[model samples]
Target: MPASIVEEFWRTQFATEPYRGGGFALTANPTLEEDRRAMLLVAADGTETAVVSPALAGVTATDAASFRAASAEAGARLHDPDLVHYLAADDRIGEETGHDIRLLTSADEDAFAAFEAGASEQDLDDAYVELDHWAVVGAFDGDELVCAASAYPWDDTQLADLGVLTLESHRGRGIARRVVRALAGEIIARGYEPQYRCQVDNAASIALARRAGFEVYGTWEPVSPDQ
Candidate 1:
């Protein structure tokens, strides 16, 4: 897809102004959070747009003055802040290891339960309730699910947003990476681009995305009302 098309898709999805490449654009209705009320998009060159949804309208710093004013506002805070990474199907690197990785379905409730133990409540809901829209994959250590990954279709587009989680005990064992590779491969086979999103402070997730050959493309900072 063209860069312009990608930008338009995001802008429309968030109900924001047409992205003009650089600087910041503000929108009243952020698609991710119904209660966020306002959003800000920052782009380095103009092709990649980073989303920042503050609880209030004038919160995020577009320039300097707005930022300070936002900071002074009462009950202002950041939420769901993350960096977005895009990976082309052809650019995906890594081999599927011998680990027992398989597609997850509702029948695999036990495995799903184990996987959910490592994921956030919101993610668990997205993975299960919307199971039809996601390609779920799980890695098992014997009978125990050590890691899980899901590729969510992005707004009916040919793009898949990848989310992965691993049991605490399975950290550093490359299980997450393996599961991601398998899931990404499946996504590619289905004719879609895979995207990896990581929180700005999540060092492990960042490292894993890089190792999996996903290049940093953009960033998103979405704030919620409760914050």
Candidate 2:
């Protein structure tokens, strides 16, 4: 319930998806065709477990302290405590921005690289998280990529994840917002819902998602150090 915990959870999802920090585990991907499991983590008391991912096979605790002790005892093999509080944004929402953003694929490596540069390698690896179930979009300023977004391909039961980044020098032009909306629009067209989640403390990102027509569905908690 604490905002700090909420921010931690969202950051975990961010680190795993667009960044690939290897701090979390993968539950579902195109490669493993089991069942589409809920990525949301829940505590034993029915409270939404914060920071921990549902993909974790062992260890369960509701409170931050218990989970951390168990998680660490297990060699940190559990979900990152900082992963809770990530709010899934709605992809069904749309924006009226008229940017020239469009989808990009493997063939667009150059463009991806342009976006990848100065980005976390963890992101490059997990970029597939979106590609596996979302369409990736890139905004080009002439030949250079300035912004990007990805749409969800899964069902409403699944959470639609969105990530956007702007070239440092190109910030404040609303390019990130345009690309996010463009990708989210595509997801909606596919009959899937889109969700926007960002760190609670990331005022810039939270503002962008809000302006782009996304509302916070729920918040997850993060593991606390002293917990």
Candidate 3:
């Protein structure tokens, strides 16, 4: 029941121009979108299904138990899952934070650069956060930026994709969650739903999403190419 709100929309989303998975259900999505060779979308309520390419459907399995084996045999190995999160319109938070989190612009280039310079290469790469995006926010300490988030359109849809990064030295203070809540409001104000995605094994990211009041919409992955 938790995913009832998304049923009609997600089915339509997959059936439209780009994806064209017209028959979205617990069964098959007849016409698979090229970009998404195969997808297993498990709704928040635990309802699960797969949208597999017609060419590969015969060998694919929809059940979680056999999905990995079938996908692996077809060259699209299913290893780690990708969790997708969404903030419902009613769940929007309007609370203010003690930290100095604000929307950023090109004028703050140097500050953003210094924040990046202070982070380790490995952490930055894994964070998948960038300074350039449709909407950027920063959490400041006095005048120094320690946490940042970038939001961009996802699949050119009404969903705004978001990524956040907090300096290793500045973590555990709830900066990421506060910054995300502030940004989600901005995304909705701009006429788009805020969407967050992260790998299943990423404990830190999962925690952040939970703390930010985001609900797990689905676990999606490509059947053939990590889809």
Candidate 4:
């Protein structure tokens, strides 16, 4: 695999080496606010780091267990970890699914709204793809938008994070594979790295990432939404 952009992105955030070279580094996350967010970032090399906001930084240490305990004490519970994948440029394997996936724009507003309206709330939240987002792409089923993808730069990094949604009635048709390939290719052509993230429990997303040429980079346990 090419050098992991995952490492490069987090490095600037920590203001120090986030990688422990197979160890742990519990550090304060400058970007987070107190009592707002706390979580863990595990690098591909087995390096674990407890990323807590500055306020809670004093309560944790270089121990992963202690970091978890501290986070719980701060009234924040660990959420489901997200499996992270970086697009493997040299290893990009392609497939032909007979879907004419293309880049979409604001002109496709009505179609995207109709597609979004057809998706359930759960699906909408899970996919997180939006038509008005930074970049949009999709495929049509005859005249209906059956599936779409969108991306945004991850933090301030060159990594373009990806989200893909397939119409509930149109999954299992290989639209996802083609859509992802098209979007990732677009991101690459724009001179940015592509990153795919999904909950570890999402079997379908995991499978699609692999088949679409994304390599597992690491797992991130970000703070759960405030409830």
Candidate 5:
């Protein structure tokens, strides 16, 4: 990825309280989280391979046959009665039901505060800090921020990145769509490509990406145990 784009992605991830305990991790980081998480689960008697950070808990099988069997068993177990949503990502799934745009600013700490109040700890579990590379646009209803979209980290190698959100109370309306388009336009104006990712099973997010002219590049699993 281009250094600029890469830098921006990290910035947005760390911002808005979305990233809490888990810090920035690249796939090739010498100290891989997958290796670490696998070691933690060593007593389970399972072969291990690496999945990316923050998702799949970084557990796969070292042995192909054993891995396949374990994957099947894991899939079955994931669907069992106890686990609801075995692996979840902050995939930007839900829709905006009904709200007007209030356009937020950095000075509007109250909006961030409200956003923090309405946000889940899991939603806030990323760890990134600098955001000099990207720009942002937010949607608010009155003083309450119902949705937000940010554009940052654009350059030659990495695709431009966007981060978007809609409050839980706001769904089904075109609020998310509007904010996304607004953010995408901003990203284009800044001269970088835009890339988006969501959980494999998240229909709403997949639909939104397609609607916004994004194709599935690939899937990236997050691997922060704290998340």
Candidate 6:
């Protein structure tokens, strides 16, 4: 698919990443917060573009230059800077380790609540409650939830972005991989492509995506206000 089409889908459906060729295409959305608005696009031919809305653009004279500087500073603060990876599903060859994986719904509130109780971070819980295009699959060991994966609509087209979480006690096992595979399978069966995104420094997540047959195609990093 052309990168332009992908950009359109992301912009219209997800209200983000409004990329057009080597430039940015602005779209009006009253709900977008000025401080949280920014876009970064790295094209296949090595061309790149970074855009900030008019409200935030004045903070820096050049969006691309400011974004690059921010990314460099972020990298110095940590082992790796924040990055968004574009991934596509390829093949599925991992064994299904017999963990029961089930889709979550409003009826699964109790199970979700239990899973939330063990959550190490808040993003999953916040997305679960707020996103309308969200879908979740949880992996269970006997009666306990060990890991879960969730996908949210990525664009107006057939694309979904996914995240996975495995309880601290279950890190080494393949539960994360299994849950992601199951979630990706469902997303594909529903006629959408699954996109796996994670921080570049998250080795466990990167390995899980690879184990589940996803390959990285592109990377993006945004400029934060503090930077």
Best by TM-score: 4
TM-score of each: 0.66, 0.54, 0.84, 0.85, 0.49, 0.64
Give lDDT tens digits, candidate 6, residues 146-225. 77778877635677888777777877877777778888778766866777766667677677777877765445554455
The candidate with the higher TM-score, 2 or 3, is: 3
| lDDT values, one for every candidate | 0.63, 0.52, 0.74, 0.79, 0.45, 0.59
Error of 2 at 226 (Å): 17
Task: Give Cα distance to truth, residue 63, candidate 3, Å.
Answer: 1.2
Q: Can you list the residue pairs that collide in candidate 1?
A: 21-46
Score candidate 3 by TM-score against the native. 0.84
For residue 12, what is the lDDT in candidate 3? 51
List runs of model 4 lying over 4 Å from the truth.
Answer: 2-5, 18-21, 29-37, 75-77, 92-97
Tens-digit lDDT string for candidate 3 (1-227): 22333444567545532222232343445656665655566656566566566666676464654665776677666546689898754684696487998999988899999999999898787766777789888899988999998899877667788989999899999999999998888887887778888988899999999899888877776644434
Count of backbone collisions within predicted model 4: 0
Error of 1 at 177 (Å): 1.1
Off by over 4 Å in 6: 1-38, 43-47, 51-82, 86-97, 122-133, 155-157, 223-227
Best by lDDT: 4
Which prediction has more favorable lDDT, 2 or 6? 6
RMSD of candidates 1 onward, in order: 5.3, 10.2, 4.3, 2.7, 12.3, 6.4
Between prediction 3 and prediction 6, which has the larger TM-score? Answer: 3
Taking the tens digit of each residue's C-alpha lDDT, what string does model 5 give over 1-227?
A: 22344335434432221122322222212333332321111101221222222443343554433433443443311111110111112223233334554335567677766776786665543211112326666677787877776655633344655656666787576777777766655655565555554455657766766665554432232322342
lDDT of 1 at 168: 71
